[model samples]
Target: MFAGVDIGGTTTQVLLCTADLAVIDSTEVSTPAREGGQAMVRAALDALSVLRARVPSRLLGIGIGAAGVVDSRAGRILVASDSFRSWAGFEVTATVEKALGVPAFLDNDVNAFLRGEAAKGAVVDEPYVLGMTLGTGVGGALRLNGELLDGPHGAAGEVGHIPGFGDLPCTCGGRGHLETLASGRSIRARYGERTGRLLTARGVAEAAADGDPDALAVYEAAGAGVARAILITAGLLDITTVVVGGGVSRAWDLIQPPMLAELTAGPPVSGHPIRVVRARLGSGAVAIGAASRARTELDAVTRV
Candidate 1:
């Protein structure tokens, strides 16, 4: 058995899986985002204990998918969003290993999301791909030749922070980032700016579904921004296969038309048509991907 944990800003999910990564049991807990790293880990530990109690197999190892720039080699979070207090610089894998008495591995949450899709979800078995997650914030990851690439600074596929989308300020203190145009929070803010009503992203989607021109325009702009980012990635990396996920992607009906239009308008120089699809694993992707990572690491250690 192996344990997979995904620690998000609002919730922490834990999954117990077999050697092949089939989930045997799972649980979730509210994350103490403002309370500090130790509290958040404790919440994950508590949920993990519940799952472990339900499963009879001995856990072989653990893998953690956390929201931040992770140093996979060091099993630590190098940088995190402002939503998490004291998350950056947290010794995640070490602390979890000490608490659970097992070998552990860690990676950025977006990386894990892409790995999950490549392993068993939408882009299963694909060699080269780009993954985007448009939640409260946007995140990205790259997979090439069947392996995820984590650059020296662990920010190789950080497409959200790249500038030139618009003049809006990003949560990372940058201006003209893709996140400002495509993230869930940004969608809501954009809609609120158009009409003085502050609606949630979901509400805006609902309004768009009802043919509200303002809402439609907002989603179209977001789709265009996303398309531009995808095009930039394709041109740079020669990766035309893209998979999108996260809360904002739920409004695929509202976002896809303009995105496809933009992609069609400017074909890549390589002439390869871009293929974009929604994630299939839903909210379970991170945990499953984490378990897959644990299995891979454990197998490597055994060979060594």
Candidate 2:
């Protein structure tokens, strides 16, 4: 079997899988932020610490799906923010390979998530897809004609830093980016400051479900902001499927209607009907995708 590791802001997941991507074993663990990137790598290795007994031999090489800009070709984590302070400039694939004595394929977390979904989960076989995660911040990816649009610089689907937005600051050191308006932290901060409820984004969704007008309005604004970004993305890219993922997906009851309304309202330039929907696999998409990558390695190892 091959191993796939998906490292996120709050959690990390590892899985072993067959060549066709059927999961054989899996583990989930907390992300070590205070300990930073090196510690996080250790934790990832530990996640699979028990897999030796389940496999025939030393398992296949590992593939890491990490948060932020990952240079898949170079096996490096290229971007770091407050959420992933330890990952900036870390050559995670090399470190893990050296430490564990296995090859690894590294990629940005969102890219991995999309690849997972498209390969086996929600958007599989779809002609085009725009995967957006509304967790701590807004992370995005585009799959066009069944290929990931990672761009030459590995920053193609980064919709978080789009311009012409509001005054909210982004963790990426930019103002008016989509993350300031659409992320879970941004939603809670904006609503908490305005409504004085100090509720988390999940809590706000529950409140909205309970018919709290203020909380409902918070989600409405968030959906509207996301709509703006999605519309721009679709217009520029000609994509039609938007799979909304992350903590915000939990608030779909409050967010979906408004988000759809904005999409249907039509962009200034394009009037194509883009379908916006909830992510099918929820938070598991990353782990599932990582598992998918691991499955690829399993085939290679058996062949060798």
The TM-score leader among the candidates is 1
lDDT of each: 0.91, 0.80
Where does candidate 1 stray beyond 4 Å?
A: none
lDDT of 2 by residue, 52-160 (tens): 5666555666778888887878878777777666678888878888887877788788887887888877787887888898898889998999878888778888887
Error of 2 at 230 (Å): 1.4
Q: What is the lDDT of residue 171 in candidate 2?
A: 82
Worst 10 residues of 1 by lDDT: 48-57
Tens digits of per-residue lDDT, candidate 1, 112-164, equal 99988887899998888999999999999999888999999999899999899
TM-score of every prediction relative to native: 0.98, 0.92
lDDT of the structure predicted as candidate 1:
0.91
